[model samples]
Target: MIETIVFDVGETLTRDDCYWNLWADWLGIPRHTLSALVGAVVAQGLDNAEALRLVRPGIDLAAEYHAREAAGRGECLDESDLYDDVHPGLSALQQLGVRVVIAGNQTGRVGELLRGLDLPADVIVTSAEWGVAKPQPEFFHRVLEVAQAAPDETLYVGDHPANDIFPAKAAGLRAAHIRRGPWGHLWADAPEVVAAADWRIDSLTQLVDVVRA
Candidate 1:
C-alpha cells in the first residue's frame, strides 16, 4: 500500500508555461520557437537546458538566471499557476491520512513561491535545496529519506519519464506517469513509459483514488 505520494512540480502540480515564456522573453525569442525547440530537445532525450544553447550558443545560463532575478523577472508561482485539481486532490489525500509531498526539479526560489501558495502538502522541497536533481539515484535516496517510508510504500508522480518515472522506479519507488505537459502528452503512449509506470493517470484527482488502491 502506498502511504506517501511525492509529486513533481512542473506539469504535475503546476503548469510551466510562465517559466518558459519568461525565458523566451529574456532571450528575445518567440515563445513558439522556444517551445518548439524545447519539444525537439525533449524528443531527442536531451535536457531542456539544451534549448538555451540552441538559442544562444556558448551562453552562460547561471549568469542569465541571476540577471533575470536582478531585473525582478524571476519565477513567481501563484494560485493561477496551479492545476485546478491540485488543491482538492492533495487536500483529499491529506484527509485520507496519506502523506502528500511536493518534490521536483525546481529552484529553491520555486520552493519559496510554492510555499507562498499554501498548498495542502506535508512537505515541499526542490533540487536546488537538496543539491541533487532527478534522474539521479541519490536524489531518490534523498526523497526516500524525506518521505520516511519504504520505497515499496511510496509513490512518485511526475510527467517526465526520464527525470521522474525511470529514476524513481530504479530507486524501488512505485512510479505514476501523468499525461499532461508536452513531454507527457508526447510520450504518453510510448512503450517504455507504459511499461515503466505502475499507474498512468490524466489528472491529480486520480491520485486520491490511486493511493486508496
Candidate 2:
C-alpha cells in the first residue's frame, strides 16, 4: 500500500497562468501568444524551455529569471490560481495518514510561493533546491529520501508524462497519469505514456480513493 503521495506543482496542484503570464510580460509577448507557444511546444513533443529558445535566440534564461525575482514578480499567487480539487484531495490524503509531498520541476522561489499560500503539503521540494530536475532519477530518489519512504510505498502524481510519470516509474515509484493539464490531456492517447503509468486519474479528488486503495 502507498503511504506517501508525491505531487507535481504546475498544472497538478496549481494552475500556471500566473507564472506563464509573468514570463509573457518579460518576453514582451502577448499572453495569448505565450499560450500558443505552450500548446505548440507540447504538441511537437518539445521541452517547454527549449521551445522558448527556439522562438527567441540568445535569451539568457537565468538572467531573466533573476531579473524577475529581483523585480518582485512571480513571488506569490492567489488562492484562485489553484485547481478546485487540490485542497480537498490533499486534505483527504492527509486524513488517511498518507504523507503528501510536493516535488516538482520548479525554480528555487517555489518554496516561498507555496509557503506564502500555506498549501497543504507535509513536505515541499523543487528541482532547484535538489540540484536536479525531472525526469532525472536523482530527483525521484531525493524525494523518496525526503519522504523517508521506499519507492514501492510512494505514489507519484503529475500531469506531465515525460517529466513526471516516466521518471517516477523509472525510479521505482508508482506513477499516476492525471489527465487534466496540457501534457496530460494532449498525450493521454500516447501508447508509451499510457503504459508508463500504474494508475490514471481525471482529477485530484480521484487520488483520495486511489491512495486509500
Candidate 3:
C-alpha cells in the first residue's frame, strides 16, 4: 500500500503559466514565439535550458532570475495558480490519513512560497533546500527519509517523464505521470516514456482514487 504521495511543484501542483510569459518578456521575444520555441526544443529531445541558450545566445538564466527576485518581481504561486483539481485531491489525501509531500526540483524560495500558500502537503521540500534535485537518486532518498517511507510504499507523481517518472521508478517507488503540463503533453505520445510510468493520469482527482484504491 502506498503511504506517502510525493508531488512535483511546477506544472504538477502549480499551473506555471506565468513563467513562460515572464521569460519571454525578459528575452524580448513574443510569448507565442517563445511557446513554439519551447515546443520545438521538446520535439528535438533537447533540454529546455540548452534550447533557450540556442534560441538566445548569452542569456544568463540565473542572473536574470536573481535580477527579477531582487527587483521584487519574482513570481509566486497564488491561490488562483493551482489547478481546479489540486485542492480537492490534496484534501482527500489528508482526510485519508495519507502522508502527502511536495518534493520537487525548485528554488529555495519554493518552500517559503508553499508555506505561505498553505497547501495541503504535510512536508514540503525543494531541490535548493536538499542541495539535490529530481532524477537524482539522492533526492528521492532524502524524501524517503523525511517521509519515513519505504520506496515501494511511496508514489511519486509529476509531469516530467525524464525527471520524474523514470527516476522515481529507478528509485523503487511507483510513479505516476500527470499528462496536463508541458512535459506531460509533450511526451504524451512517446511510448518508451509512457511505459516507464506505473500510472498516467489526466487530472489530480484521479490520484485520490489511485491512493484510495
lDDT of 1 by residue, 76-190 (tens): 7899999899999999989999888999999999999998898999999999999999988989999998788999999999999999999999999999999989888988999
Query: Clashing residue pairs in candidate 2, if any?
Result: none
lDDT of 2 by residue, 46-106 (tens): 8877656755788898887888888877455678889998888898889989998998998
Worst 10 residues of 2 by lDDT: 47-56
How does each model score on TM-score? 0.97, 0.94, 0.94
Query: Per lDDT, what order, best first?
Result: 1, 2, 3
Better structure of 2 and 3 per lDDT: 2
Residues 1-213, candidate 3: write the lDDT tens digits: 889899898889887667777777767778888778777887776766765686688988899889988877776767888888888899888888889999988888867888788788899889999999878899988988877789988999998888888888998999999887768898876898778888899987887788878
* Residue pairs in collision within model 1: none
**Candidate 3 local lDDT, residue 119:** 81
Ranking, TM-score, top scorer first: 1, 2, 3
What TM-score does candidate 2 reach? 0.94
Candidate 3 positional error at 145, Å: 1.2
lDDT of each: 0.92, 0.85, 0.84
lDDT score, candidate 3? 0.84
